[model samples]
Target: MKIMSVFGTRPEAIKMCPLIKELQSHTEITSVVCITGQHREMLKEVLETFTIKPDYDLNIMKKEQDLFDITLNILDKIKAILIKEKPDLVLVHGDTSTTFSTALACFYLNIPIGHIEAGLRTYNMTSPFPEEFNRQAVGLVANYHFAPTEQAKKTLLAEGKDPKSIFVTGNTAIDALKTTINPNYTHPILEWAGSSRIIMITAHRRENIGQPMEHMFHAIKRIVEEHPDIKCIYPIHMNPKVKTLATTILGENDRIKLIPPMNVIDFHNLLNKSYLILTDSGGIQEEAPSLGKPVLVMRDTTERPEGIEAGTLKLTGTTEEEIYKQFKLLLTDKVAYNQMSHATNPYGDGFASKKIIEALLQNKKD
Candidate 1:
């Protein structure tokens, strides 16, 4: 069976790379990878980390590329590959434009789609900004819904998706940790963050870009000012606007380092060393807990609620006051911090790739 795995962006690459390797190893399946390069530079690091040289590179990244640009560009470029290979299944992950557009193209080509990390829902489309809509849209056409948790599968069932088509394979984010985390890993950042509590920052959600983003920054800035024993390292996003805001607000603090994005290995190592994680991102919510680091999500909602339910995450929302209170509590209250850090991860057991393959291969005969 021929299977094409299509993904773009750092989160997708990190999660998909492990699954791609498993697909390649499955004797019954011929795995092919196509990258949309939704995140060119950040995506590259993960691809290299996994040793995945893509069969196709759309190279769609541009200056100030919007959702329309990414969607249309991937649609135009990926159609030809679909036509040529005509794979038995086109696999897409999560709710990125690359996932939705590629799945849409496969739908047009009459090829089946297998959605990884499927059935996550915030219900509110405006909060996650297009992601909620994207995943739901993928749900509409997906033949196989590879949900990462039982709760996610329940979301699919509630949405009226076929029970026969849904597979409760745990999140591939946990699977990725097997490859990323290393005890011997060391970097200058770790050295600088030595002995002091490292508060890792990764806030670049589309909805949190304006006042919400400023609020998040102000809260972090205040926390840094008050807590002299801790160092905050913000490996910022590639978006120029995000960089400008991050610099203008979170800069000037010698303890706060606004570094460019690090590779997956470095990022994972940093997370492993971090005392706390503050983010508006999704992947970090899952990854940090496995490393025994507590995460404070600076957003109103999250699709991956299992982390919060498992006690590893606290949704602080995008407000200066609320974020400060939660963050400060985690730092000051060792009991609160330990409870979160020691909580078992509800995401996966590092076998999501194999489970996804088993389910796919079982159904491939259809």
Candidate 2:
């Protein structure tokens, strides 16, 4: 089987690289990797961590690029590659412009698409901006839906996706964790944090950019100020607005360290060592639970409701008061913290990549 796996962005690369490695192990499968370069430097970090050299790089990233730029550029560039490779199946991960645009190109060429981490939904399109729209649009045309959980499979069924087409493969994010996390890993930041409790932060959602983002930062700032023993390390996103806002609110605090994004290995190890996490990001909701870290999701709504139900994540919406309340509760209440930390991760074991490849092989035989 000639299978082309298409993805861009750091999160997608983290999840997809494990599956790509799985694809390469099978003699019958020709694994082709194509990166859109939607996230450039951050994406490069992950690819290097996994030692994945792409067969094709779209290199479509630019200064101040918007959804229109990403969508149009990917649509224009990936079509020719699809025409040339003409793989038996094209796989896309999650809901970036890369996934949507690449799937559309495959649709145009009559190439079957297998969507990894599929069937996730917030239904509130405006909250996650283009991501909610992107995933739903991909669902409409995907030949196979590799759902991360039974909840995701249920969502796909409710949306009228074919029953036989969906498989409840555990999240590949967990699969990536198995490879990257090192118990003996040490970094300068870890030394700086010393005996202080580490609160790892990642907030770069498009919808949270302006005032909502400020609310999240302010809440974290309050927590850091109140707690002398805890230190915050926010690996700031590449977005300039996020950089400026974060610097303004969180930069000067001695307890808060606003640093550039770390590679996946460092980031995962940091998450492993952290006392807890705070974010408006999607992948972290799944990733943190596996590491036994309690996550405070600073968002109005989340598509990953499984994490909330499993008690590993708390949806503390984007507001200064609400975020402050939740953040304080987690710190002060040991019972609450232990309950969240010990909660069973509903995402998956560490073999989602193998399951995904098995599904493809079975489909090929059938």
Question: After aligning candidate 2 to the native by TM-score, how far in Å is the CA of 40 from where it should be?
Answer: 0.7
Please write out the lDDT profile of model 2 over residues 242-280, one tens digit for every residue.
999999998899889899999999999999999999998
TM-score on alpha carbons, each prediction = 0.98, 0.99
Alpha-carbon deviation at 238 in model 2, angstroms: 0.5
lDDT (CA) per prediction? 0.93, 0.94
Can you list the residue pairs that collide in candidate 1? Answer: none
Off by over 4 Å in 1: none
lDDT score for candidate 2 against the true structure: 0.94
Cα deviation of 339 in candidate 1 (Å)? 1.2
State candidate 2's TM-score: 0.99
Worst window of 10 by summed lDDT in candidate 1: 357-366
